[model samples]
Structures are given as structure tokens and as C-alpha cells.
Target: MSRFPILPRHQSGFAYIAAVIFLVVIAGIAVVLLRLTETQQSTVNQALLASRASLAARGGIEWVFNNPVQRCSQAPLSTSNAAPAGAVNHLTDFRAESGFLVSVSCSFRAYNEGEAIDASGNSSPVVKRIYRIDAVACNGTANTCPDTGSVPRADYVERAQVATICLLTDGAPCV
Candidate 1:
């Protein structure tokens, strides 16, 4: 019996299938990597926005400290209407060199002490003024003033709330 010449079975099709599978896996991995990179970039951007907001809030507090008369005046900071208690009032909007925006608000409350005997048996009633200031900074836009029931944000926007009580001791300390 004559044996047929040895012939190799066709295996070229298997190579193509293996290559396709490998390429699919590589594409999946690439997508995952791209998503991770995007998330990291977003987080960094938010952090930067927060930092700018905080700086703006601090600037508002300092402005109040510098202008004692304006802080105690009945005239509101940014409006002609009288400032009401438990209300937020706008103060200023400043632009930083880096293009960040800062906004400020101030609220004032007056407290009066009952007449009492002093160290020398003198009776007097002391009146004190307390100023609650709120400042906010935003990276790309301005935010509304914070209210009593509002929650504050940081970074893209930052809020700073401060309550300072100044005794109206003949207006010496306040001035």
C-alpha cells in the first residue's frame, strides 16, 4: 500500500482568532486607563476651585475688620436699604490675579445689657454690637449669599462665616 504524501492540516485560521482576542483585551484595558485619568483630572480641578473660595472668604473678614464704621452702620454694604437681622448682605466682589472671584456679606445684631452696678457702685447699661460676616469665593462664577438654613461648599466655592462681637464702649473699640 502506498501511503499518501504527508500533508499538514491548515492551522492559519487559528492564528487570526487568537490575534482578535488579544486586540479586544488591549482595547478594554485602554478604556479603563482613560477613565481613571479623567477622574484624577476632575478631582484636581475641584481642589483648586475650593482653595480660591477660601481665600475670598478670608478677604471679606479682613475688610470688615478694617472698616469698623461701615460694619456698624445701618446702611447695608451693597444696598441702600437697611440691613436686617439674620439677613445676608453683599459687601464686595474682587477679582484675583488668577481670575478667581470673591464675594462678601455682613449682618449686624445689637445687644443691650441690663443696668447693673459697676465696681464703684455705678449702674450702667452696656450696648454691644455683634457682626456676623459671611464670605464666599468661587473659581469661575459667583455664588449666592449663605442663608440660615443653607449648607456651605468649598473649593469650586468656599464659604467663611464669622461672628464678631464688638462692645460699644463709647464707640472706641468699634472705631
Candidate 2:
């Protein structure tokens, strides 16, 4: 109030402007961080689903190898997938947490005694059986189609595995 009189126009709101700018930068950084997190989460989810599908497919192949006699069973009834009286050769499904579906099929083909026989004329009786296994695993939750006994949709991830097994060795020369 003495001789020095400060004018209102001399005061500047530079501090307020700086503060607003800082806040805006912080908000942008937060948004970017959130986006990155979401992307990472999605990637992890896809990887886990793929692993589960692979395991499901592998399980089917293992089952066929473990049960060689079942592969020689009679053909399934045309009306139903149930085993023919005593044999058990059919498609089966397995899952870990219920969202995965693994379709497994076991089939067999017989080769002549000259197929893989050794040099001797006698063929080993133990080597009489051979079987093949095919397994396909996919995510059932992504399927929108009903169970019409057809193939799964293309959108769902799928894994396939195959294995051919021979039971024993033969002595007859195979040409």
C-alpha cells in the first residue's frame, strides 16, 4: 500500500498451466499401461488354451498305444459308437477343465505275412497285430454347432496326433 502498486495483469498462471500439462501426461501413460496389460493377458490365455488342446490330442494317442488288443476289436455298429459286444475300437473325447474336447479314433490294417517278416521262412506269431491311432483335439466352447457327429468348426484351435504300432517281430523274409 506504499508507493509500490502491483497491477493485476502482472500476475501469471504459469504454475496452473504446468500442473495441467503434467496431469495430462500422467493420464496418457496410464492408458498405455492398461492397454499393454490387456494385450499381455490375451496372449497368455491363447497360449494356455493351445497347450490344453495339445495335451488332449496326445492323451488319445496314448490310450490307443496302451490298449493294443482293443484296436483289433470288431467294427462299431453303424447305428451307434458303442463297442461291438467285446471289442473296444471307437472315437473318444477327453478334456481337462471341460472346455476342451479331444476326439480319438483307433483303426487297424493287416499286412501279409511277407510284410515285415525276417529272413527265415517261419513268421513270429507274436507279430500278428498292428494298429493305428488318430486323435484330434479342439476347444468345444468356441463351437456353436450342435452334436451332429460331424467335424468341429474352423474357428476353434485344433491339434492332431497320429501313431502306428506293431506288436512284435517276425522271422519270415518280407519282400
Candidate 3:
């Protein structure tokens, strides 16, 4: 009765189903790209924070080294014990940025090396003082070095630096 043979109608709405599948795949790829971008941004931020922390720690070390007389005087050698206790100094928010804090620890030891003849032809003991310094910088609380808060944060950063210096004392107090 039909002029033209009717094709099978089982393929009805095939285009709609195909379109939905394509949309879902495209959305999934978009989500993946967004997530990857976010992760990369986080890594870059962490690296920058780390660099800031390192520079802050170096600044603390230099500060202590420059003011040896005052700092060494504060760290008195202990006679009671063979090993003296070191002195710890804190410079809260010392860096240009408000997020950074620096803490410097110093220890001093005096020892007599070999005998030396002075210009007056008098023999004198050569006294040498050794200074051990450590500087720690952190983006934690304004008053502390390491972040000791109960809640741990992914953005927290910290760096530590150390140096040792030896000075010859000519019968005077070693700074």
C-alpha cells in the first residue's frame, strides 16, 4: 500500500543519545583540566613561600653575626656544666612581610690554643672563642619559629640556617 518501503524505526532518537554521551565526555575532560590547573597553582604558591622563608632565615643569621658583642654577652658560658646552654632570641615579624618570623639561637665557647709571644716579649696564651649560631624562620605565628598550632595547614612554611665563627681573643673578652 505504501509508495516507498518504510525503513526500520528502531533507530529513533539515536542522535539525542549520541549528543548526551558527547556532552558528558566533554564535561569530564573540562573538570579534569580545571583540577590540574588548581594543583599547579598550589605548587607555585608553595615554592614562593619557601623562598621567602629561606631569605628571612638568612636575614636573622646576618643580624646575629653583625651584633656579636651584644649577643655573645647575653649568652654567658656556664661553669656548672661542661656544656653550656645556648641563648635563644626571637625577632617576631622581623621580615618586611608580616607573615614571617625569625628566631636566632647562639652558643659560645672559649678555649686557649697555643702560647704566643707578644710585642713586649712576654708569652701569653692565645684565647679563641667559638660561636655557633642557628636561625629559623617560619610563616607560622608571629612569635614562634615552627608552627605549633593544633590545626595543620598546607600553606605553612619554615626554613633553618646555621653558621659557626671563630675569633682570636687577645687577652680580652671574646665577642
Candidate 4:
């Protein structure tokens, strides 16, 4: 029998296959990372919008408080005599400054002003006036509710309300 010499096989094909597999894995990882980044960015944007909306609401409240003559009643009285009773009363008196939008509503209700309890187990009549302000900011071009985190369709409303309390005293600050 004649001994045959063994020849080494070329590994170029193996190298190519390994490189392709590596590239595929890298691509998959990159895609996953991109998706994660997108999600994070959306969340951050929503949060920012919400914060701005809240500030706008607060601004409305401040406006109402500052302009008591227009936003609130001259005298603290019961809700029955007022135009509208309860918290839902329409204020319809507010002004929006530049870069802000505001709407204000007010109503009067009789509440005990004194902290002490009377002998009849009832508190003294304070007759406080409550004002409600609904304000919103058109931040950017997005028209979606920040809380829901979804696209808003027709008839979708994105407004925030802030209620303020004021005493019956002269020049009393809103609580």
C-alpha cells in the first residue's frame, strides 16, 4: 500500500460565515437599542408637556387671584343669590397673557369660617367664595393628552383646572 500525503483544507469560507453571523448579531442589537431610545424619548417629551400644562393651570389660578374684581364677586354671599351655585359655576372672566391661555369660573357657597364647633354641632357661617380656573397651554404642535400618552382624536380636550378659595374679608387673599 502507498501512503498518501494529507493536504490542509482552506478556512476562508469558515471565516466568511463567522463574519456574517457576527454582523447579523450586531445589527439586531443596534435595532433593539434604537427602539429603546425612541421609547425613552417619547416618555421624556410627554413628561415635559405635562409639566408645562400644569404650570399653565397654575398661571390661570394666579391670574384669577390677582384680579379679584373681575374673577370674584364683590361680596361673599350664599350660592342661591349668585348667578350660579356650587363649584361648577361659570366664571367667564379671565385674561390670558402672552404665551399662556386661561379660562376662569367662580361660585359662592356658605361654609363655616370659624374652626370651633358650636353648641348646636354646627360651624359658624363663613360664606366663602370659591373660584375655579381651567387653563391649558398649546405646547408645541402635538395634540395629545399628556396623561394618556396617546394620540388625541376629534373632540379630545386637554385642559387643567385649579380651584382657589377666598375669604369674605376686604382684600383677603385667595386660599
Candidate 1 residues lying further than 4 Å off, grouped into runs, are 1-10, 72-93, 114-122, 140-162, 171-175
lDDT of 1 by residue, 1-175 (tens): 5588877887578888999999999999999999999999988887776666676667767876787546546453331233454444454345535444445556666666566578999987665566666666545444454432233443334456564646464554543
TM-score of each: 0.65, 0.60, 0.80, 0.59
Stretches of candidate 4 off by over 4 Å are 1-12, 73-100, 111-127, 132-159, 169-175
**How well is each residue in 1-175 modelled by candidate 4, as lDDT tens digits?**
5598777976568888999999999999999999999999977866765666567666656766677545555543443335443232222222223332344455544344555457999864444555444444433233321324423542222457656566553445545
Q: lDDT, candidate 1, residue 9? A: 85
Q: What is the C-alpha lDDT of each candidate?
A: 0.59, 0.58, 0.75, 0.52
Question: How many angstroms is residue 18 displaced in model 4 relative to the true structure, after the best TM-score fit?
Answer: 1.7
Winner on lDDT (1 vs 3): 3
Tens-place lDDT digits, model 2, residues 52-73:
8778778767876675544545
Q: How large an RMSD does model 1 have? A: 6.6
Report the error of model 3 at residue 59, Å: 0.3
Model 1 clash number: 3
Which segments of candidate 3 are over 4 A away from where they belong?
Answer: 1-10, 75-85, 93-98, 170-175
Each candidate's root-mean-square deviation in Å? 6.6, 7.7, 3.9, 7.8
TM-score of structure candidate 4: 0.59
